[model samples]
Each structure stands twice: as C-alpha cells, then as structure tokens.
Target: NRCEYCGDENGPFEIHHVRKLKDVSKGTEKWKQLMIQRKRKTLVLCKTCHTDLHRGTLPDNRFAA
Candidate 1:
C-alpha cells in the first residue's frame, strides 16, 4: 500500500499513531481504555513522510491536535 500522507510507495513505511501514547493519562481507567483505543488508530506513512511528520513539516490531518 502507498503512504497515506505523501503517497510514496518507494521504500519502507511506518505506522504512525494518530494519538501519542505519552499524551494519554495513565492514572485513570477511562484514560487507559482510551489509550488502548487510540493504539488502534494509526496511519501508514513512508519513511520520508514519517520523518517530516516528526520534524513538524508534514501537514497531516491525523497529527493535528
């Protein structure tokens, strides 16, 4: 499959989590459940797009707060 962001099908791809694990609260059960649910939400991105995403250059809607 192609990357959802840049549509690159070249090299390797990575599964980028829509919600960061660190942002989820670990103290509450509800938050924990939410964290688990969030884990299932991910986006496939190419290596370049993934790097751009982490560098805050790619304007992916999934990473928007």
Candidate 2:
C-alpha cells in the first residue's frame, strides 16, 4: 500500500489514527477539519511524514489551498 500523505509505497507503515477518539465538534485546525470533512479518522502515512506531522514541521501546502 501507499502512504495517504506522502504516497510512499513502503512497508512497516503506520496509521496516523485508528479512530476519532478526541472531540472535533468545533475543530478549526486543518487536520481536524480534513478529518471531519472526509468523515475519516485514519491516515496511512510513512514514518517520515508521520513524524513531520506530529512535529508540525509539515508545510501548509501539504493540506493544499
């Protein structure tokens, strides 16, 4: 399979989230908004991109304009 974020076809991959455990009733964050819009909680991502995500190092364009 490929990473949903980086499109990396790598094994030993990790899912960003398993389910929407936290609240998103009034989420203004891009990621949270994306999740709400898509009605999906999971994001298949490579290790590198996943780390960059948690670190908030990913570029704003990653989410697109």
**Candidate 2 — which residues are off by over 4 angstroms?**
18-33, 62-65
Each model's backbone clash number? 0, 0
Which parts of model 1 have CA positions greater than 4 angstroms off? 20-40, 59-65
C-alpha lDDT of candidate 1 relative to the true structure: 0.58
Candidate 2: residue 16 lDDT (0-100): 78
Best by lDDT: 2
Superpose all Cα atoms of candidate 1 onto the true structure and report the RMSD in Å to 1 decimal: 7.7
Give lDDT tens digits, candidate 2, residues 1-65. Answer: 77666567864577777355356536665656666776777877778767887897855456532
